[model samples]
Target: MQYSISQDQNGTHLDWQHKNVSPEMIDWFWSNMEKGFLLWHPEEHEPLQWVIPPKHGNLIGAVHIAPQTWSDGKRQNLYIRFEDFNSVPDAIKQYIEYDHCIIVAGLGFGEGSLHVKEPLGYRIHQWQSDVQNSNSVGVIGKSNAFGWKKSENHEQGMIWAKHAGTEISNWGLFLPQLFDLYKVVKNTKYNPFMDLSVKRIDGVLQYKTAN
Candidate 1:
């Protein structure tokens, strides 16, 4: 929820512990994440589904998976590209390369490496930052299915909302938007969905958030 991103003298860092990493991998991740922070067993809610060590967080540059991605419909934790952290200055790059992708007519996108959802059927939303920026996803969807739009009144700042006055509202708002716009079509195949705004809850980051 409270995702951290920063840079340092040695380089830029974005660290967070994961219950899905291994001792060896954690060591490798931390060694290079000069400016990254990782809290093992993090008390946050992230859509990432995997079993990593509660060790150091990963750098945007140096983590690697042998297979890259999966073809079968299974959740993947390898969205963020570890290789990009190799930047000499450690600054997070704005773009990266993508090699694998699914082929389709109306909906087709390359495996954005770090995007939350697979890009097989959804229409690509935008050009990726680079071949190594597996840290986040660009907008991805079809033209009619759930789509994203900027809120006219929106500005720049951390935001929060209360559904029954609980923090869960932050993610609840995100889940539906993803499903209705992308995942829903992932399984149900529909159109005309919705969009969501980036918001924050007590410093925690949520869908569409940039800072």
Candidate 2:
């Protein structure tokens, strides 16, 4: 396992990686894991594997793990904030009525979505876009970051509506893995532990191929 635990005033955050992980290891992490988690897709596997822990307490925010498939046929895996997944800001929760996975708000603690916290707010450096593109992909929430545009092009992760009292981007941009997840499954509400903890969450996301 690989990990990095850091410290700040509000609390201490830990990030780590584990190799040869099974289902139990993943259970331990989500249960004992810190509040901050973000993984990247390994960038090698065509499609990887990932596991989503059951709803932990109140999910503050979360993103599907990424860098997901770069191991020896095992798979690459990364992290997304837990808040994004658990907060799931919709009533019907139809981020994709067809798919079943919904993108919720994240640490979007400041300007981007909602959440008034300072440190977690959307970082100006992390937020960028090109007004140049007048074309987008969807209708409801097209432009990423802050839905800055009213057109269509490649608004990769703009899927769900935001929960009130929060300002985090609940959109799941094409993180390579999620892009593939969107293509394959029935949804992303994964609670079944098929003994996979060190795999990419994107590949793990369960989607049903349209018959």
Q: How high is the CA lDDT of each candidate model?
A: 0.22, 0.26
lDDT of 2 by residue, 28-130 (tens): 2332222212322213423322233444332224333333222234342333343332233232122222222223222321133333332121111011122
What is the per-residue lDDT of model 1 for residues 1-211, given as tens digits with 9 covering 90 to 100? 2223332222222222222222222222223222112122123222332222122232222222212112232322332222212221112122111211111111112334334232211111111123233434221111111111212111111111111112222222333233333423332112211112223456432324111
What are the clash counts of all predictions, listed in order? 31, 50
**Per-model TM values vs. the true structure:** 0.18, 0.21
lDDT of 1 at 123: 14
Candidate 1 segments exceeding 4 Å error: 1-39, 45-78, 84-211
Q: Native-vs-model 2 lDDT?
A: 0.26
Name the lDDT value of residue 170 in candidate 2: 15
